[model samples]
Target: MTKPDNPNKTRFGFETRMIHAGAAPEPVTGARQTPIYQNTSYVFHDADHAASLFNLQSFGFIYSRLANPTVAVLEERLASLENGRGATCCASGHAAQILTFFAFMEPGDEFVASNKLYGGSLTQFGKTFKKFDWHAHLVDTDDLAAVRAAITPKCKALFVESLANPGGVVSDLEPLAEIAHQAGLVFIVDNTLATPYLCQPFDWGADLIVHSTTKFLSGNGTSMGGAVIDSGTFDWGQNDKFGGLTAPEPAYHGLTFYETFGDLAFTTLSHMVGLRDLGATMAPMNAFQTLLGIETLSLRMERHCANAQDVAEFLAGHELVAWVSYAGLESDPYHGRAQKYLGGRAGSVFTFGVNGVTGGYEMGMRVVESCELFSHLANVGDARSLILHPASTIHRQLTDEQRDTAGAGPDVVRLSIGLETLDDLLADLDQALHRAAAEGDKAAE
Candidate 1:
């Protein structure tokens, strides 16, 4: 059967491509929507055809463990959006990170990472990876000298978040990517917070981009998914350090990925070997939901950023607020970096400290609990506002010093601004703040 050509020919904008790309009218049924291929296996022409599929000589789905048609469309769409050679979807963002590392790093290898990161990522690198004999050196990535000093001979990658969680620090990907290349290390960027709509890591020299689609990519809170996009720009053949790509694969007929697949080796291996062996494949239904959310990603992000800016400004001057740390604020230390990298929109998530006039941690919790419009949840990047006290929740396992570094303190509250009206959000916050303060005063009296 001849493959149908892509429907839209013109180089449409991101939003346009989101709804049109990877979607074509079904040739067999003439259906307008991309139908879900829910079956676990596809019928082969014969035994020889099945063998060719197993050998990676042909592109056809033999098993859902390796690939699914419904999932493939989403992967292709994400790869196009990211300007990457290809993408591999997984169960969650953490699964994508683990699978990506497993594809490149051998036991006893190390990677350098920024100290400021999502609490889950920090825990994964600092604790979980160690169990596999893979080590991570945490360093202050903002200081070039410090980054250079922390690299060891065994270091294989330099990892950073495009826009860090909680702290809202925007990484200078260009400089960092250059540093990684100079050091003969792969540059891995988590584009979860910024999403591809606001920033494409590959455009700034990133070799690999990872996303927790559960956040902004999904837009709504319906599904949990993740993806890893390979820019195919990194020359794995140039260095002997990465033998996984350059060396012969003992599992698949001694295939040398770099020689056989070239630019697509990383993503191909991620799907064929990483997800195949690890069993971290994303569900076809979830991928479909993610693709649905991605269709309006650009539109939702604009509103999210605008609403967040208004909320940030209001919190910055409020008497009940002790401090506001939003990159959109001119007073923020990360303002310059955010402006340079975040395309003038400082994102929807920011952290602030409620004045202890409400007492300490307990009062802060009350403020979060009292909020009428904002849901108290752990996740971010939802269309609805989310509130969380990370110190008592996500970062509770960390020491005080560690908490400070991760931007989660007893008085600190994190907000994931949604598309709600600015007036409604502010009013809800105001009522919550007053109630928390009154409770604190009663306790003191």
Candidate 2:
């Protein structure tokens, strides 16, 4: 085990922390990597110890469903990556979103959310979330007035994607965070597309940062997982907005989380109550895979960004392409915001129009079909390139106006650039575009 000089002091770089942070050599066998504790239950030293753990007096593994050493390390690793006080791993990104809201909202309480979100998230909020009486007011997050208007007395949180899905639009986070704070709302950002390697939402005033680790964090696309990072900066005890964290609980013998756990209150509460009741815990095996993936996060993201920029540039000037939506491109509408918040390299996932919104939609489908290097699928952030026609697949549930408003126009093609050589990826796209153009000409003839 490599003990840090101090918990409060961070001396190592991000890449170094990705591999060794929250990990220790196995005491018994000197295992260098985090070993998966696949058991369902852990043995307590005695009844006193069990009571101590159950009462939240001390931290120890009680059940695999709530906490596991392997999973804990993954959580800690994620927390380290985000420079957060803590993080909780869950079954999926969708589960993370629900659990996050559960921390602050009761039934009938509402939250404000960005309209430009993953299709799954939009459906989860617009459709499924209503079942819980947890309402969401969706608006264009970029519109400051709309965002301010969305907040009401019942608004408990503000949610948005750090790097929006489909369109790859970068959310202007600082001002939004200020808006959320002025209203006493928890600012939650989905950092799935950007990952911690690209952007740390906490640094920009986000109280909570969420991730779909199934994407870039797993790097190889072998696992499905989600993570919720707590910045440990939000003061739940300040008001009734986060009563679940501030109030004494019937669930845990009237122990208040904010009082008991201090900065780590939200994370502790989510682990003990949210995972226990909701049963959306991430498995030990998946956690291990995600940990492995994060070790190379910095490296893979560099390549992903480089390849995506090249592809975006090529498509911007292509005769068959009408426009590109990558923030890395100088011509992109989001380039300014990207430069201000996301550093110079605007992540790997982006969208482009093959022809025009009308003709492009048809070409988008054919191009997706014709692509050889890029896998035509719904998931993004894999080491292998991926392509998805959101208008037909992910965003099919949304109406035409909704889809277009969210930047998933019928002609838009979302690409998750990978670690493949730039030449190979561009060549694949070139061939696919030519094939799609030929089919279009034949149909026109």
Candidate 3:
């Protein structure tokens, strides 16, 4: 296959790049859309070519389990968008996290991470990772002093979410990156909430970026996929701590990744070893759907941000609302950090608390259930508005103290604003609020 011209030479802006980067007319039929290569294996030129491909001396797809043409296009596009050297696709965001750990961590090793992260991630780190004998120290990532203090000699990486989920807290990536570098550790960021459209973590000094493409990248609530993009900036050769990449490998015939692949060491090793062993590779069909969704990412994100601002403003003045926690609002505690990092667009998700009369959590649940325009669902980043009462649903797994730490209190409701008309969304909220109030009043009486 012929390589496309350099994306940098085109001087394309983000929207144009989203639609065109890493995409070209189909070689087979001149088709405009990206065609999914559904075959399980590719043919070799001959026995010598097959031998070379299997030995990793030459680049060629041997099996869909290792790589697929459809998935490769998506990976290249995402890498270009994120300004990373390369990327690896996975079945889900959790799978991407596991692959990252498998590549860099070992038994008895620890990593320092932010306290404010998605609840699912918190559980994964605090619980699931223990099975591997790896540990995590959760610290306030915003406080550089605390982060520095938490980093032990055993720490191999610094993990943070660009914009934390549910809580909407934004980490100071530049400072965090500096800390990681000074400590001789890799820096990993979960960019699922912010998306590349809002913030590219690599620009702020992250070494490895992870995303759940099932969300904003796939824009319309279709397909479950994830990605890990290597910035190709981290010097594995400089650090003796990361022996996984710098040391000789047994699986690849004593080959050292840093010596062989240089900047692409992390990404290549992630695919060649992590994916091969873990079996978390993404399907070609899912990658195709995500690619289609990403093409319109810039446009969808604009609408989502605008709608969220409208809803946040409306909620702030409502008598039924006790508090609103949207970073777009000046009243929010994280407003300053959000302004500094979020490019003036405080994403589409925020949490608001309803004033409890006598019904308490029931009143909040009623408000969520009564919304006609917003679907009550666990997912976000849909074209349609979505609402969730976490205390009774997503955060139910946490204890009261844990729920508070996760920012999912009983009266709080999380909203993912959609492309629906602002007026219609307001009307739905108005009706829901009234219904909730009436139910609360009845309970009080």
RMSD of each candidate relative to the true structure: 4.0, 3.0, 3.5
Residues 294-319 of candidate 3 have per-residue lDDT tens digits of 99898899999999999999999999
Compose the digit string of candidate 1's lDDT tens values, residues 233-307.
789977788899999999988999889998879988988899889998898888888889989998899999999
Candidate 3 wrong stretches, greater than 4 Å: 1-10
Specify the poorest-scoring 10-residue window by lDDT in model 2. Answer: 1-10
lDDT of each: 0.88, 0.89, 0.87
Residue 253 local lDDT, model 3: 85
Q: Estimate each model's TM-score.
A: 0.96, 0.97, 0.96
lDDT for model 3 comes to: 0.87
Residue 106, candidate 1: alpha-carbon lDDT:
93
lDDT, candidate 3, residue 184?
Answer: 92
Q: Quote the positional error of residue 100 for candidate 2 in Å.
A: 0.7
Candidate 1 worst ten-residue window by lDDT: 1-10
